[model samples]
Target: MRRTRAATTAAITLSLLAATACGGGSANGDGGSNSAPKELTYWASNQGPDIAADEATLAPELKKFEERTGIKVKLEVIPWPDLLGRILAATASGQGPDVLNIGNTWSASLQATGALLPWDGRNFDAIGGKDRFVASAIGSSGATGQDPAAVPLYSMSYALYYNKKMFREAGIEKPPATWDEMVTVGQRLSKDGKWALGAEGSNLANNIHQVFVLAKQHGADFFDAAGKPAFDGPATVDAVKQYVDLMAKDRIIAPGNAEYAQNQSLQDFAAGKTAMVLWQSAATSFKTHGMKEGDWGVAPVPVPAGGAPGTGRNTNSMVAGINMAVFRNTDNIDGSLAFVKFMTGDEEQRLLNKAYGSIPPVKAAQTDAAFASEDLTVLRETLSTSAAPLPQVPQESQFETTVGTAVKELFADAAAGRPVTTESVKAELTKAQQQMTS
Candidate 1:
């Protein structure tokens, strides 16, 4: 989801001191002389299934960058879990890489640190213009009316992924458009030791996203005006109840879902052990898991009855994608900015997202052949018509973890065959809401 730079051990302290001693280049004139080539450190997010795959995909592009600008970029592909901690360390030490990839949802959080350069006016002018990217995506880079602190590099949105074979066998003619219909359809489709839905119940990121989407469908905002979490509302409680009921009441989800992570849920759907899962940017991973393109179908996530329309409020998916930012204190600031612009350019975006099975952030790049399929078409439409950024607040990460842990607790009860009432769900949300303030 995000990526970037390093440890704060004693050895790292020496490295930081040495980096500080070297000093940064001035942001005057050409930024760097042609006779003396500039070098920039870049921290790339692990986009592919493995880090090597991302390195391989980016090699030629970095080579092209060198050829074009006489700037050599040293790339480090960081795993998701370690990225945020590394970034926090780097930001604190003032010894981070020149350019880095970050989760789009984290843009606001990271921007609050004041370690990233503002991509507005002249900086924006360097990379085409502010109008170059999709409106929703650029909007995600920072708070509204502020210069974006990062540039959207890859774009993604959630969608309902279902096994076509399972649906057909169950006599289901179409994907459900509402939550109630999904329950009915799932009941019919679940049998023979297989389930209708698979969830990454143990995964905090996955759990939080499901909660967000469902809560939005019920017209609940995780945060109210003034940025305080409003998680214990009736709508929020109902959403959690419905989610937990997939196992407890509906019996359409695997009992083992409590321990399942994102990959496991995806594997279950790919293996045909589950009929459906909510996923994003998983086409390549699914193919790698032995599923062919035609074997599965993609549809927008189902909302509740009387929920918002496709283009209406709370109907959008989260902007669960990554972004690129330049460190404000980089010696090679110009080169870092240039590298970011290069990576997010139309051609590079097409190449990289095609390799990653993701959508390009640039609006026109979505028209590429790699993105012309029916599935990606649905994702693209979601991005334009229905995608919303996660709540923009300083406490966003805390909210995610708190609510996610609460959902995990619900899952544990469901897995152990315990009844999870609406009241119980309310208690979990209330506990999470309290944690947000602490």
Candidate 2:
């Protein structure tokens, strides 16, 4: 759900060192004696098409919160590219907002810094008990056997979105249910300078998300059970090769897509330049691009030929979403908790998730009729039944950076007409694995 920079590994390592040196103290540098402030600074992730749009959507909600609790919230919607690095810098300096949004996959890696307030029993109780959140949403909140570093806010899962007009024109009856079917259907749909599939090939986070699912279908993981890098394993290599082949061998994706780091693929889908896109909770995005509701259809992402959609080898998506976390050194713990409570409240959950076209992590809010549309139903089912969380290890962020870059380079190679063979993919992955250690 978030992108990582090539320098992320060093940035995080340095931040960890700075946090260790700073020791524990209040965010204001007070000796744990500051009173709760009248206003709380909140760092929200950019959820809408742009930062300005997110600001517009959240303005009324924050106003409502201010009226209800008499606590004003100052909001800054940070873009995805800068969000993680900004958070790491804040952790190091002990100068961060009282609360912030984090990509669920970063929960464990960030928790290792000891800068976030842990959602223990007391905190969960303050926010109406942990049971209010869906289990799948909770699974990615932190590492196994530890207090969650944050609470689930939004829940999402990847699904295949196809243009119905393209399908009808190609004489295809349904979206693909398996990898082989996807290629076959894609071949039929690709013609006349139009691609069958669209991809953010240069996007580190998008590349990681796709390859992660492919690796799962191949009965592999980027990391082994012991949390060590296993990027070049046979199954993993096969999975990466298969994904690159979508452009290289299958020729369903355009070579220009190799440079698509922004959400160009989604735009292409909206403009009918492409037939299908694999995305997480993309309904809102489609609508924002002026795409009509009936123009497209949603289905589960394709799995392996014989595999049914479920956990492990059949997993079709990563548990994708955002989490809300409080800084442990915040000067206004009560106000921060109140803000979190207000944000996670049933009414707010329904309102915000609907506005953003995401599924609410709150169990009660999720059942609202607004979320019962066909597209949401497919995403909800995928999240509950087939999604797997990425490795909740401390080195997870580094893994995203190194391995994602490898896949990006491979895409570039494919675009340049170089063969994306298993051996070449394995070589790239091996280099990625070594970077993690070096």
Candidate 3:
């Protein structure tokens, strides 16, 4: 979990050309002054139409930006799950918004494409410099080979979310802080033949993030300096065993969980079919299918067995947020930077946090009463105190996907009553590492 400007090295100098154009990107800082009126196009997750409260709040902030900097932000919101494919296609064709919001995990893969603008003192002064964001999150956006290429945006992390009602019914006093305890409590809470652990199997990455956080709790680093697989180590093996045992040995999770992805289990959890789930903190707060505030509670991920006492790893919350970047090729670097600065500035972060329940990307904005009211202060606390970020390597995203996909399959095997032999896992992991390291 590292962040900051990488050393000026050849391997890291990504071009500022739009990746979609398949053209060479210029790294030169041609961003001009904020004196002129400039139109800046933005791409954001469609959290539904702008009528939604969260969606609607940006107007005031945008207006303020326009008045102050003479830059107009044309925001295009795309739903989270449905967005990646279109953005990738658009980017590959070298045409995308001058600034965009993207998942942190996507940073590495995107960096690999050799497009996107790098942030520095000249470009980022309006958005707060390296000092204002959480360190690990800042690192989440940088590639090891390059300078600090991206800035930290709003972020979220995963932990075990439990139904308070279910916990009360089971006579549990406090949330489980260890894997063994989760199994015991989950078993008790999951009754009436319903699944105890409702993991959406198709969403292997989310599950893996949870488990890997646990592995890191026990101290596992997946890749070394060369960006090679280090997953075969002891901590990781123990972590995988724990995950498999929850379903195969404990019989605590739902049946056929292998077939289910995030949406399925979210439906199950909202419907009260399961008691506990390891998911993003924001998932519980989602207002779909009648999800309400009192329905759930967030807890730190349980420590792995034999892990350090009083020591739990905050799996680096995926430093999730939309960053503002200028396409050097966009012909409006100053406009793009101005738009990014305004969109990610203190006022906007405070407003966005208030409207969307997002933790602020800039540290100066965290004092807002809105974050305190939503009680989302913990998300910021966790990212600062416990979480370690993904490595600042271009290969990190590919490796995470590989591991996530493997976990998905392995969990499926556990659900089907198949033996999780070491040989099988080693083979799968080896295959994944091969494709990635190549």
Best of the candidates, lDDT: 2
TM-score of candidate 2 to 2 decimals: 0.94
1-438 per-residue lDDT for model 2 (tens digits): 011223132236733544562344555432232266677888999888778889999999999989988888889898776677778767766667788999999898888877788888888999999999998788898989999989999988999999999999988999999999999999988899999999987788788899999999888899988988899999999999999999999999999999997578989999999999999988888999989989999999999888778998889999999999987777777888888999999999999999988999999997789999999999999988999999998888778778888999999999999989989999999999998776
The ten-residue window of minimal lDDT in model 1 covers 9-18
Give per-residue lDDT, candidate 1, residue 80: 65
Score candidate 1 by lDDT.
0.78
Clash totals, every prediction: 1, 0, 17
Cα lDDT for residue 115, model 3?
A: 55
Q: Which model, 1 or 2, shows the larger lDDT?
A: 2
Full ranking by TM-score = 2, 1, 3
lDDT-superior candidate, 1 or 3: 1
Ranking by lDDT: 2, 1, 3
| Stronger candidate by TM-score (2 vs 3) | 2
TM-score for each of the candidates: 0.88, 0.94, 0.82
After superposing candidate 2, which stretches have Cα over 4 Å from the reference?
A: 1-11, 14-36
User: Per-residue CA lDDT of candidate 1, range 1-438, in tens?
Assistant: 122334642112222342442223245422222222388888988777668878988898999999999898888998765576677677666667778998887777666666677776788888888888888888788766667779999889988999999999988999987888889998998899999998988878778778787777777778998777899999889878888898888988988989986478888888889999988888887887899979999988887766643654457488778899877767666677678788878889898888888898898788888898878888888877776678867566567668888999999999998889988899999998887665
lDDT of 3 by residue, 1-438 (tens): 011222221112123213343343453644333332477666666432223543566667777878887676776666544455544544454555666766676666566655566676666665556687766667777676565556665766555677777778778878887777878887787678776777766665565566556676656767765766677666776666667677767888875777785456667777788877765545423456567877777776666555432324535343445544454345456677666766667877776766666677787888877676333655655565666666556555456567777777887788777887766666667676776655
